[model samples]
Target chain A: MNTSSTFPSGEIQRIKGCCISLPGNDIDTDRIIPARFLKCVNFEALGEQVFADDRKELNGFHPFDIPINKGAKILIVNDNFGCGSSREHAPQALMRWGIRGIIGQSFAEIFYGNCLALGIPCATIERRESDELVESVRNKPLTEWDFDLNKLEVSNNNISFKLSIDKGSLGMLINGSWDATSQLISQGEKIDKTIAKLPYLNDFF
Target chain B: MSKNTLYDKVWDLHQVGQLPGGSTQLFIGLHLIHEVTSPQAFAALKEKDLSVRCPERTIATVDHIVPTNNQQRPFADPLAEEMLRTLEMNCSKNGIKFHGIGTGQQGIVHVIAPELGLTQPGMTIACGDSHTSTHGAFGAIAFGIGTSQVRDVLASQSLSINKLKVRRIWVEGELAKGVYAKDLILHIIRTLGVKGGVGYAYEFGGPAIKLLSMEERMTICNMAIEGGARCGYINPDQVTYEYLKGRSHAPTNDAWNKAIKWWKSLCSDEKSIFDDQVNFNATEIAPTVTWGITPAQAIGIDESVPESSSLPKNEKAITEEAYSYMGLKAGQEISGLAIDVCFIGSCTNGRISDLQTAAEIVKGKRVAKGIKAFVVPGSEQVAKAAIHDGLDVIFKQAGFEWREPGCSMCLAMNPDRLEGRQISASSSNRNFKGRQGSASGRTLLMSPAMVAAAAIQGKVTDVRTFFKTNSDQSSKTL
Candidate 1:
């Protein structure tokens, strides 16, 4: 089900290997990378700020100073994993943070599309299954999620889940293409041929 | 199969071309832009030496990065100024209409479009911001796109897309007193678990929906994205047509009647089939608030936080995490969490109705000391309307900062923000960690009136109490 085939180029990227599980919900784009960091065009440095706002100590207490999820490829988040405004850089930041994909009970539609375009697999499961996955990871920090690229599935022994992706999103990722402008430009030859046959597109050109 | 919902009908009609892979080429009828996401998209076009294929289908505005306090030139932030200038250049270069700040029409892109009637029934609307779903109020199939997709629309006037399944969310019974459209959406989100609507478009219908005004319907559809629906919409009806009639860009005379007929045709039939169906009793909904990191992690104002013991082992862990992060005692009533700040604005509940409701609570009272409260109008027009009615002065006299319209503290790209671990009773969409612009900040989502009440009491309090028996003998005499 080529979920990554039809997007514009560079929209779909592949991250190989096992997964890391971060099960927080409503982790917004700001914490994915603080707004202060957005002034720069580069997305490379954002992964470090993945949970910036939460890392601060509360006065003297360790408020959210937990260690990074140690290179988990796949992230299993709770319901509304990417809630809030549409910030495309969010998935970019998370992708750079090395999260290859997300499996939540739900995702913000725009963020879901952005993730799919960027080749970050976002899948949904029932709340019960999501809750169970959330539990499995908490019990074992080293829990590994293995994603089968061909099958488009994210699973481990304790929790195996199938993903639901729209054909365009799935196709674009699989084909490693989404920068369709350039693709359109490159398809000039084929477009020219098709247009010539149709005779109507001559007016548009 | 049976008759199709508006969602399915619109998706089918907009299917320009379907590829073998299953994703369809979806045509967009309108494209709205703002300064933040457009500069890069335009730059991409320049780099490719491509022209905007159909500039007439697009409109641009400046909202994000526009300071609500000051409108001076060459902004203190060089990047913001540059972005603004770039947007100006791009709009002119491509023959697209740009609404700059302070331009009577300058407003949040979401608010400006519908108010202008550029968004209509059966049209596919796309913007770079997620709140584009606000246009669904007019029964348009709106979706928030990305910067690259923004480029796509600018160049092609269409989106390469996959389709979504349609779900019919039917409501029965009338809402209880004091319940607004905001409460209805919250109830929907709570039942759907934020992610339940993924891969689906919600068709809101029923006696309750039919009873709502267009503006009230807008509020319901505005937050559909928050619950993970691609978009939620009511089928166009007399209310929808009335709201669009005589609007700045609405069709006129014979064209108006023609458009109305088309809109009516797009509505779902009584027996429309859906991928799924859910029903809610509007009377059962209550004014709700978010307690933890997520919108779903909340209970009604009358309910207490669920004890961790009742949660599953996994939820128990997150509950502990939320407890530690939010600094709240387990099982404590969510009603009186001490709030240090109050923010009343956002694409969600920052409309004129929300402002009017908040002003009702703040008119004769003062914001309690030690609480910072402000009301940022959703758009410049909303600000103008509020001032026309003297609602601004009522708020200011009561100690709420009356500021320029923009997506203020909602996401905080601009200067308005929260400080430290201040817990804010906000009317914005999300209550995620640092969502209101401070790393250690905490936010509780509520209606604007509830926010006003919190500002007055310096804590999360029931809003019904504010309106409850306020005309009593002694207090009224004073």
Candidate 2:
């Protein structure tokens, strides 16, 4: 199933693509996008710098730099992916790098929210499932990997495994409510109603 | 139902609504914006044709990219100048208050907020910078948001977020001499692991936190993000109220009495229960410094780094990575490792108290011949105060450059950068590889006083030694 939808008003129910696996725990945001790239004025060019330093140091042999993994749309990472920094550029860069979905053992809190806001689904699987998925993607880069958000399952032709996304986050993904800014605007009256009672906020009024 | 924790009390009060998901729509009383993350957000707002809903609620400044060495217009770096100019334009366009350089109001975003009394107890604060948690020192539930979230806050003045579990970190006992709030936080992060605070709001309290000054509390809360917490806070008490009494934004007279009453009521009730509880002995903490890439990989001043085999299985790989990146063996002692640069600034430890502590250590001493040592105040106000106290002169006499206020060398967004593989003694929060700008450079995170001690010796020296040395020198002079 295609993961991306029409801009600003759609849900990401499923994602299907070839996977590029990067295995390591606590793979922080610094490794994901590096701090230097954060100086840019916008998010458009971030994709080129996603893991730029790592790719450079590892040269042509790095997974993302390897010929087979070029343009791989799904990334499978180990535990605690995107563990540091509040930079949205990390997720924006990953998305710009052509990744539509991520499956890992876990993700940092802010990173997960940032991804969901942009219609990028970040799902978590059991350690064994994660290991098998990583191995499958690494050994067979051409194999189609399918992630079904509704079913909470990921599958290749040879194997299938159940993954977990928090129920609330899952609802947001399925129902297209993840664009929190819109939700926030729609609830403007509710915010005003609450603010009316606050002593501190009342100062401005 | 259990009595509400401090986090619960503050959160429930600020929560605007429950969203379609289980997340709460929390109203942000204050939104702080800096150059690096905000220009894109403002661009997004322009794309959406949206005006800031509550411009008065937002405050803007040029920090992440503003140079600490120079305060002139049209910054040296084109990109840096562009970023600052963009921030200026955005703030002016949106009618948000801009604390620009030379306004005597600008500094590091986190540093300037509290000193200006913009950060207060029981407030729900959001910023695009992670150290926004620094304001939590005032008992506010402050957190860092991404660029999109910044846009959201600017447009709506609220954020949709899942409520976090509250973890009460109880620190008891008096701290030993030379072990400051920085050491305490480093020690806490070391013990709990960097990811330990994930999905939790750390409610720091007990005897130790209670005794710390407001600036020290800010220093501790500033690095809560380093420990992976969404935010951290201390319940506002008499010390907190006293610190806010005469500040610019603080309420006065009858309004002050009313605000204090409300603030007092927001403190966690004695019967409040936390989702998790951890205890630390202040005396057990030493002057600490990070030896590895992550803040959690820290050791005591006199301790050696852990061997890979000695570490837990889950920690071994990262340890190995740190070894390779830092170009040091696993079991080597962190001290006496020669440092090329010493930075005494950042929201984490760039306050007046932090500078005072560092100045005392560097008094009657000169920095080593090869060391590049400098001090950057957290804000222009901090700079003016330091100059008035002659702390600037003391630092300059010790051969450290006394620079203007900004986030200098903290992330090296400006010209203050580490070249090649030079090692740094940084008072800033993160020590990630290349975090100080150069690809292969290394950073050892420590307190400002420890940094001062390191600059003088040209190596990592325990700050307590310098404390004794300075006192002895003074006694002799007298």
Candidate 3:
């Protein structure tokens, strides 16, 4: 359903190592990392704050207290994930936590796009398949989740799902190119023609 | 292709062309940007060595990180300053209009567009913020886009959106005293559940909707996205036209009449078909508050937390989870949870009427010694308007902090967050975990007047108590 132009040009990377399984629907931006962390500019430092609101030290059972998920590189989740306010930090905080990929029934519209644009693959699967991953990971300790970026395939024996990564996003993840201007510049001719057709576009002209 | 309901008409009118993969490349009439999401998009532009394709179509503002308490430069947090600088540079380089810190127009993105007349009926608006649906109040089709999609809009002024199912929410009746538009929306979300509106655009209508002032209708539409609807809008009426009249960005003279004509024609016909329909009586709704992590986990102040057994079997686990996470007991009265803070802000409830209602509640009494209370106007214009009405003086004399406009304590974007384990009585939408800023902070959603009552009692107290105790409902005096 996507073209090569959607992603960057390069070899794709695959997910390797342990994954954290959060079983819930509609885990939102405010819950991913509270707005308190939005003040920081360096996305890399936001890892510690991922799901900070939910991880609030409480009842002696913090979200971050679970060691396997603390620094997990992949996140296997349930249906309709990331459904709430459109804070860009939601994906930024997730990426900071070294979560390279997510498997879920579905992702929030704005959030899915944000994650993919930032080189994070938010894969989609049926609810049953996603639940299987959640159950399997929850039962096992530090289980490996392997998702090949090139093949757009996720497999863990218990469940496997094909991903639909947009072309521009695919290219960026492979080459680590997230510069927006460059992405647009490469498609300059198309943009120029579109702008040229509308007299209103020439406020800058 | 479709032309019956308001949704179909608006959609067909705004369609530029269809892109591949069944997504429509819908043209945007207006684009609003805030400090939080635009930096990355601007960086993408710089990388391409490109400028905003249509600068005038886009408007920028600083909101997410601009402190309501402090407006000083080179902020205490270096990152905030840098991000603000990035937006400033981007707006300048691309010839885009930016309402920066301390600007007369600066406020929350949703609040500014309406006041400045940037958001108009029969137009399509897009923002990198989810609350962009707030613009849909004026009968515009507004969508919240991601940073990459923000890039797309800067490049094309169009968004690739999936078609939505149109749902007609008909509410008819006269609302009781103290029942604000915020309560109406909260009540709807409570009945429908948070995900009920997924893949839909709510067409808010019926006599009760038409009777609401333009600002009140705006408040209703602002929370549509919270219910997972693509957007929520009301049919343009005399109120809508009157509100738009003579506004700075509104069309002038002949253009204005033509615009209104088109806007009127876009309203749903009496028998216009909708994919779904729900009806409600306005009198049945009471001032609502959420006691749990989701907005739907709400009960009226007089009601008790529903017992877990009463919920469907599938919903039990989440119900149990919410009960534990919120430290709330099943069957416990939702009216007495101790509160540490009371905030009146956010695009949802930070309107002038909200401030006025809250001011009336606080006019004669001091805030409980231990309880912290503050009011953040939704926009600079709202702030100025409230000040003109002397609402700020009432707030200050009553011991509540009257701060500048922005989405303060409403998702914790600015400094107005909670301390550890602090429970807040908030007028903002959403009662999610740590939504008020503390990792372990708790929020109790309520009307602004209810928040004022809680501030006075330092607990989840009834707003009716203050109403009776005061013996004055018409005017507030310090």
Candidate 4:
């Protein structure tokens, strides 16, 4: 895990860290943090349990268990990462484990939204680029890279690859709008107006 | 862009405004919460010094951590008890209506909302559970949100979300006698792949979908999340209205007539445009089951598991993982595979109709020796209806345990769970690695009737044969 004990706050434009690659398709939330670990009322103490079952089965060979990948802030994965369950615990566990950004071939919708809500930027690259990035990270675990939300790209001293993120999410990340509670509450008048217009709220009157 | 579809109509109706980031500030018509995901959101609200904006629009229930067999207060697990206590305290403090245990209204959040008539046509629903898509069966635009979004909804009664492209999945022909909505959805997920529906809302239509009852439609929509769709919905028809009429929260008398008239206008227009469209023949779908970890890794009952060499290169990795994880070889027949346990309950297939159908198959038969089988109704209301119709007795007489209402053994947060590497035939949405409690436990996704049939034979048997046998016995009696 990262040496810093505090979580990120405010606008997040750039994330610089070593990357950890976990290659697979349809790696679900249940795998990231098992349901048994979800009994807690808070997300604290979840970082130690992320990929708990898989790491146990792999017996220290799992990417998250490898010593060199320690404190890796960027998680590189293959297609359809986080495919099942809407437990934000999946991303929470990853975030707590020092995953500040994620680059994958694709992401499941709810998982992507969850990451954005927590101020973690998730970007997509083509399959070939994602494969090459995972390879480079696995081969050179200590190489530092920068993921730029403003430029929508990941780059090191020797190589760079463009990333793709939805405009809404990209805007939210760079402008600190991802933590949506304050902004949503600021529009209280419009909210009341919309609720007033809804037929069911008035019992179809 | 999709135009004039039910998704389009409902989303437009709920738009509070456009946010600065181009996402819509969409108002949530109904917000459902549960013990597992709500406590943290409530705590976040307290941290922010905020309160629930519209308590009447929000509902809470305890299901994920509630024991199916023993639901008395002060649960055996202190963690579970603390979570429930936190939710109760939060709801009471905020004036949010909570359907706790023994309330007769308490059950799985997804199951109770619809039965109480809180889910309806042309509304927007948000819940902290992925199966919140089940409410989409009422023609509502419902999305599963995380706890942070839950906190946002508590403070503002809305979500900052981007509009999704709509995909109309049109299915023709009727399902055969033994095939059910569960099998059909499994087949769709298999054909579409788990990621096919990403970034899109699925509009299920055509004659095949219309033929399914409201409960069956809910079963179909409940697993839409497993296919990677955030939401799935069917346009409301007479079936939808009939299911909601006379329920606790539904409009009454003159308001009911007006509601129906408004709902009728919410269907997609004849010339509606869609982002994409796919067609299928329901008659061709058989009793499908998942032999692998992912819901998309499924096949018909008669087919054998595909060899990894024969599968596309993209699917090989997960296929190999599934082969080792499930302890099955490539080309092994799915039918007749021995099952150690049989479970028939979940948000996906735990409704009254689901229970009744399974009970019909197991009425005069007994569960096979050494096979542990049980049936958990989806909600208290579902349990009451099942007992009123004698479905519970039928299951119990067949040597199956009839348990109380909760999400038991589905995700297995409660005491009911699989042990060791035991393989189970389950009627739930997911069969992910370690989804049913045990780290190495295996699960096969199938219809509830298929689960009942498997329980009788102690293996994965073809349910069509059982239906034939029942018909033959009835003919003899006649």
Which numbered prediction scores highest in DockQ against the true structure? 4
User: Can you list each candidate's DockQ?
Assistant: 0.28, 0.59, 0.29, 0.87
Write candidate 2's Cα lDDT for B2-82 as tens digits.
247767877887788888866788999899998888988899888888889999999988888778777688888888888
- For model 1 chain B, give the 10-residue run with minimal summed lDDT: B14-23
lDDT of 4: 0.93
Better-scoring candidate (DockQ), 1 or 3 = 3
User: Candidate 1's residue-wise lDDT over B22-62, tens digit each?
Assistant: 56666677899987766667877788889887698799998
TM-score of chain B of 1: 0.96
What ranges in model 2 sit over 4 Å off? A1-9, A203-205, B1-3, B470-478
Q: Is the docking of candidate 3 incorrect, acceptable, medium or high quality?
A: acceptable
Report the TM-score of chain B alone for all candidates.
0.96, 0.98, 0.96, 0.99
Candidate 4 colliding pairs: none
Q: Model 4 TM-score?
A: 0.99
Candidate 1's C-alpha runs over 4 A off are A1-15, A39-48, A54-80, A97-108, A122-148, A151-168, A182-205, B1-3, B311-314, B474-478
Q: What is the C-alpha RMSD of each candidate to the true structure, in Å?
A: 5.5, 2.1, 5.0, 1.1
Best by TM-score: 4
Clashes per candidate (backbone, < 3 Å): 25, 0, 16, 0
Q: Name the better of 2 and 4 by DockQ.
A: 4
* Winner by lDDT: 4
- Ten-residue segment with the worst summed lDDT in candidate 3 chain B? B16-25
